[model samples]
Target: MESNLINKDEEVIRRSKTEIVLKLLEYLKPYKLKSFIVILLMIIVMICGIINPLLLEIAIDNYVVNKNVEGLMIIGAALVIINLIAWILSKIRWTMITSVTNNILVNIRHQLYSHIQTLSFDFFDSRPVGKILARVVGDVNALKNLFSQSIQSFIPQLLNLVCVAVIMFILNFKLALACTILLPILGIAMFYIEIHSRRRWEVYRNKRSNLNGFTHEDFSGIKVVQGFAREKETEKNFKAMVKELGDAFIKAVKLNDFFWPLVELSWGAGTLVVFFVGYKLITNNEIKIGTLIAFLMYVGMFWRPIMNLSNFYNTLITNFSAADRIFDILDVKPVIKNSKNAKNIGKIHGTVEFKNVSFSYDDNTEVLKNVSFKVNKGERIALVGPTGAGKSTIISLLSRFYDPTSGEILIDGKNIKYVDLESLRSQMGIMLQDTFLFSTTIMENIRYGRLDASDEEVIAAAKAVNAHDFIMKLEKGYHTEVNERGSRLSLGQRQLVSFARALLANPRILILDEATSNIDTETEKLVQSGIEKLLYSRTSFVVAHRLSTIRDCDKIMVIDNGRIAELGNHDELIRKKGIYYDLYMTQYKFLNE
Candidate 1:
């Protein structure tokens, strides 16, 4: 059963590859002028190439055999001039092809970039940055080669073969037909080479993507790897990855080793057949010596282009392997799309309700079972729970990061699904557990919350979050560089800056997910005070490990195993002596210590 399923999947993948290739061909539509110019050059070059060897035949029969040196010299000069023209035309054709392919690739990359940005968080969550980068840069270049070199190289060769075949028939029909008879042998060999090489190249491309993803994941978690003393292990893993890549490449080359030999054998066989038959015809005096020599020359010329066309086909297949990987991402339709009727959340009342909501990350188990809650405007709700208690899941639902599998979540009496995602997210400010900062200045990072915000507004927002004093002390003050992920600054300092950014957003709903847990006490105090001021007249959800932060909250809910086990005021719940009470006592003691 598993083997059958695997075969079916392979068939599906092959079919999809064909579809993607057809779709990518459409990107060439806009550059009609360049395509036409390249094609025109190709025809001219092929015609000159076909006529080239005939010039030699003329020199041999009419000039050399007749003992006319002046006639030979004139014919030889004409050949030189035609060859020169062919070279120039070929150069221009290649130039146009390269120019067209590059512009098409640029358009593809731009559209891919814009589409990715429009995608929801789930799209990014499931894909790595390096994998996506490889698609845009690596895969794009692969397609570029397909358009620029493969198309340009193959077309001229194909046209040359057709023209040569026609001329050969006109000269001697029997030998021309006999020479092409070995196509079956070449076809069989090409089939095996193509199939075998494609398999190896598929592995090569996939391994490359995996290696890219590993690099991205490792670099992003370098601190963790170093702190855990896993550098040697990482090195070992990286070596294994590269070795696998090398093996795949070697496999491809080994298969390629036979490709040229097989093609040459076919060409040699055809040449021998043509030679023997033409010799017989000459001996019988059925064809002129000049015509026979010219026919042989044309056949030889035809062989080269035919061989090149096959090789170009091979290159196209391999490059398409890479292009297929890229187009796969481009072809993926985002699961979440905006509704035509969805209205922008210009202003929200902040009245939220989770009504009989249930959700599951997987089919086998439920994460949030029948969660029910409501919070009025200006209310601060604190969620407390042991790890894996669905506390974070609840927040995800509230923020519309994921919709509930069952039931509805409402913001100001409107179903969240019906609201514009961009507008909805903009109205909600989040201080995530892992705050991300770009390799930019402190002022810019803060101003990210409001792009049009001026320097004065940024300063005020930083001060409001008690981040101003520390930021001002830095070497560049507001212009201080916060390296990637704020690696240059201490954890507490980064959190302070993140807090200021959130404050600047001034969201109708604010969330702090252990927003103060990583900061020092001094900074914690500053953050706590900042929270107090920022939450004023705004709906807030605080997810804290330390119960001390929620004492003054309007309400507290203790989640257990994806269900709300208790809900009440902190003091009220403590008196009741239930789960919330027990959790508070244990966590509060740890905080106090």
Candidate 2:
């Protein structure tokens, strides 16, 4: 039963490989003319190669034995010319094929990256950055040799092999048959080698991905690791990952190393058999000395192609595994896609409504229940909830990051699902607890919110967020380079910059998700007026860690267990003495005491 199950799985894998190859061929359609020219050149090159051996036989029989120097020189010169033409054709074929393959690679990589961008957040949430990078970079690179060189090499070798086999039989049937006695044995060895090597190659690729993931994760968390003084433990873990990767590579290489020796064994055995048989035929006067010599050359031609084929087969199996991985990512259709009838909504008035909304990451577990809420145009709404009470989920839903499981969210009476994603997102600005800044000048980071913003406008936005003073204090002012993720800046400084970015966007709807969590008391106080100014005339949802920040908001929603436990202004909620009042008292107990 187990064997049957494994056989079925292997059958499925074989079918998948066939489909992937077919899909990849679609990318080759544009290069058909060039590919056809390459095929023609290979055919001419193979003809040239075959004629060389026949010319040698003629020179020996008609020129050399008769001691005719003139005839020898003529045939020798012809041989050199034929080889030169073949070399030129082969070089041209390589150039043409390489050009086609490079374009195909670019197309494939572009398609993969574009598709990944369309995928929803859940896709990224489930996979690590390194794994995605491995598929995009390493796996795509592995297909380079397969596409550019494999067709030219494999087809020419196969033609040579077949042509030699036919010529040998026509020259001497018995000798040809004798030489091929070990062919079946060679084929069997190659088959089993591919089967085992494929499994090993898969293991090797998986280990490589794991190693990439580990390295990226460790480097990304280097600060935390050093702060906890876990450098020794980190080193030990890294060593273990490297050892596993090394072992997997060695195992795969060991399997591959067996292929060349196997080819050599078959070649040597075939040559010995042909030599013995051809010598007997020559002595018996059944075939001439020239024919015997030609037969020997034909044996080499046959075995050489087989040897080349064995190497090609090794490359094919390894790259096929890589191709399989790349196609796996391509096959994952984005779960979220706009419907055919979806309309591109124009500028929204920002009257947001969630009607009987419910959400779940997975089917079995619910994160938010039938929650409903409304935010009038330009009203400031604050959502106060404990960790995991679905506060962030609400913000994500509002932005249409993830669609509600069973309800509709409308902006100005228009279902957001119908809105063009770009048009919808363009009018909303978001600032999260973790502010991400690229490695660029401070001016560029602020201008990111509005790419077309003038330098003066960027400085104005920065000034509005109280970020311009610190930016100017730097040696280069707005031009000062902030390293990766703005590592050079203090946490409060990063948040201030992020706030400026959002403010500059001038979004009708703004979301501040614990945006001030990292700001010190003094910094928060300094930026409070700037924050109030930015929030003016914007429909805003502030997920506040410091409840005092939302005291003057139009409404304060105290969420508990994904439900609205209390909903009113801060003063109204405090008078009601419910969940809001309790949370407000507990979180502010120190200040009150």
Candidate 3:
């Protein structure tokens, strides 16, 4: 996983540099009119900037030298008013530019989030939550400056550079030529710095993602760490990750620090060349003092923009790495999505068929192979299998969490792949062995199954699942907090709530994976009644650990090595004395022991 994060093919990296920039810039199209107005304001601001020094030159050369007090006062008053007007226009431009750019950022973030929701389960299986959050939260935030400052800062500085260069040449060509010699040299130096620094920034970003992944992984499993007395070991691992991230950052910063010094050196060199040449020209009377002073002022003005642009470029170089990561996520097409001509069946009758269906995780290791099955609209089937025998994979495929590599899964004689995903999934209920409850009140968590369910309906669902009695035992009843992953609830209690949630959905098809495994025998009887209610008139698949559900199921299939080794009810399977017979015997013996 770490290798995948840091290593990029040369071609991929080269292509992304261009693609990421163009993709980021595309967000501006929606607000182009406001952007254009900001550009016009920037030009006006640069015009005001250019005129100030020229006005200063005029007052010094014409008014002061001629000893005209009234002329000096007039030029001085004009300078103050021009600067005041420039400041006001700048304020207006900042407000407008921020509004436009902030809107663009918000839109991009939302689009990225919505895109993530459409991605396949396999996409998440290959990534850590922290790494995903880094892109959605951290990387997107990094782009805020790129938009907000691009119009207000980069464009104005660029215009200033152009205006300064043109004015310098117009004022005196020879002095301008001498002063401008350092421009290309500095540009080349900064270009080299940008290339090297970008590579370091990419490394830093990858390290930060790795650190986030580790931090999230550790905290999520902190209970295991403490239980096993591995706190010191975990602490050491966390320190190593943090140090690696810090080192990567320091290396990038060390390279980035070269920019300011290079800018300062180039500015000093340009100013010295202009001063020496202008002094010689003045001694020769080839130019006036006012022109020489203006040339010096233009040289200084020119370097200020160069410095600002270099900073902006530095910002772009740093942020482009983050942008590339973000685009990488957006570029991932979901492995499971609706076909172009997909149908919305609206509602299904719950009949499910797996026609020679086969599946693999990575198209390499097969989990299920040409397995065929049929379930009637209201039949309940129990699957019994050893660990890694592809029992859970069956339900996952039925839920359309993944697509089969070969054959088809159909509902009501319609291919699931040809059905609209939202409509198809809305009619199914899934409950897992490890039921996950959100950090909210039980009422809200139960309501998650059907968002518009009334409070009374929610309570009724809880009662149907036999969760209401235990829930009422809490101080706040249904309003009691579950906390993260329902840490405050017992394993059986949490499963009961999940059963309630699934019941509230009132799906036509239901999947319960080891739902009765963790409960005590007494609790199991209560849950069994709820399960019976949930399965009434609905097609249901049960992967069970206990004997009662298996004995009562309409059919029991013993799966082995991705194939159906035995299929029958308990009495028939025992009479046949096959794999299911052995499994049933072992389970019953264990329960008796």
Candidate 4:
């Protein structure tokens, strides 16, 4: 798993930075008008800055030296007004660009989340939930600065750099040429530093993702950790992961720290060149002291932009990995999606057929092989199987959570592959072995099955599943709040609520995959009665290991190694004394013992 993750990181790094930038720009297209206004404001601010030094040079040479006090006062007033105007424009520019970048972030995050929802189970099955959450939450947020800085800082500073250099040359070409001699060398050094720096940031991001995954898993399973007295062990593992993340962050920061000093060194060197060259020109009486002073100011102005641009580049290299990770998720095409020609399979009659269907979660192993089955409408079928015997796989295929590797699944004589997924799933109610409840009231959790269900209807569903009695005993009855996964409720109570939820859906096809496995014997008897009522007039498939619970099922199939080993009514199967008979006898004997 670690090696595969390493390969994925390397692949992400190999993606062109230009590709990431171009993809990011697409999000900005919607706010182009606002962005244009921002750039225009920036241009105005740049012009004001360029004129300031020139105005100072004029005031010193033309007014200050000649004892023209009134002229110097006018120049000083003009400088103050121009600066005020520039400051106001900068404020407006910052506000407008901030709105644009924020909007872009919202759009990108929304797109990523919507796409992830459409992805198939296989995508999620192969990754930890914490790792996926890191991409959706942490990685998307890292891009916030990238977009804001690109418009508000990167473009403005780049333009400032060019404009400053141009004015410097126009004022004194000799000094300008001498000051900029080290630029090419600085550029080359930044280029090499950026290449190494970007890789470090990518590593840092990967380590952060790993830490998030570990933390999420550790906390979610805290019950097991404490129950087994493994808190110290888990803590040790968590500290190691935190240390790994911290080390990666420090390495990236070290490279970034080198960036500012390098720019400052070049700026200082350029200053020395300007003074040395300007002194020679002064000695020849080619340039006045006022002109040399202005030249010194321009040198400061030039390197300021270089420093800002370098910071922008630093922001880009550090957060570009985040952009790349976001796009990686966006680029993933959902393997299971509605086909172009697919149409709604409106209101299926619950006749299900799996014709020579085979499936595999991956390339190396087949979970199900040449499995064929058919069921008529309103029939109750029970599947009895050993662990990993492909019983659940069959149910997953029928629900179209996954498509068969080969062959076809049909409902009401229509191929499910050509059915609109939403339409098909709407008519089926599925309850899994694990029950999940949101952090909401019990009434709300049951209502989740049918969003439009009224309070009375929700209560009725609860009554039908034997959940109403227990619920009424709570302080708030149905309105009592529960934590995530119904952690506040007992395992049996949670299962009862899950049962009520499925009952409320009123699906044409009902699937119970070990739905009563967690309930106590007394509660299971209550739920079993509800189950019989819920199964009436619906095509239902119940998967259970407890043979007694499924004895009254119309037909029982004993599955072994991905094939139906025996299929018959309980009496017929008992008479045959086959796999089903053995399983039933074993459980029956264990109960008596």
Question: Which candidate's lDDT is highest?
Answer: 4
Q: Per-residue lDDT tens digits of candidate 4, residues 474-572?
A: 999999999878999999999999889988999999999998889999898788778877898999999999888888888887888988888888999
lDDT of each: 0.82, 0.86, 0.86, 0.89
Best by TM-score: 4
Model 2, span 1-593: residue lDDT tens: 01111001111133255676677778889888888889889889988988888999999989989999999999999999999999999899888988998998999899999988998887787667777787799988888877775667677788878988999899899999988999899889888988889888887777777777777777888999999999999888788878987998899999889889988988898889888988888889998888888888888888888888888778877777778777777777776767677777788788999999999988887888999989999999999988999899999998888999999999989888877788888999999999999999999999999999999999999999899888999999999999999999999999999999999899999999999999999999889988998899999999986888899999888888888888899999999988888888998996778
Off by over 4 Å in 3: 1-16
Q: What is the lDDT of residue 225 in candidate 3?
A: 91
The stretch of ten residues in a row with the least summed lDDT in candidate 4 is: 1-10
Show model 2 residue runs off by greater than 4 Å. 1-15
TM-scores for the candidates = 0.91, 0.94, 0.96, 0.97
Pairwise TM-score winner, candidates 3 and 4: 4
Tens digits of per-residue lDDT for model 3 on 46-128? 88889988998898888899999999999989888888988999899889987997798788789889999999887787677
lDDT of 1 by residue, 1-593 (tens): 01111001111144344675577778888987778788888888888888877887788778888999999888888989998999999898877887888899899889888887776566676566776776777777777667775557766677778888888888789889878889888888888788778777777776777677788789989989999999999988888888987988798778877767877888899989988998999899888788877887887877888788777777766775776666666666765666779988669979999999999876899999999999999899999899999988888888887878999999998888888998898999988878888899999999998999999999999998899999989999999888888998888988888888888888999988877788877778877788788888899999988777789999998999999999988888989999987777787788679
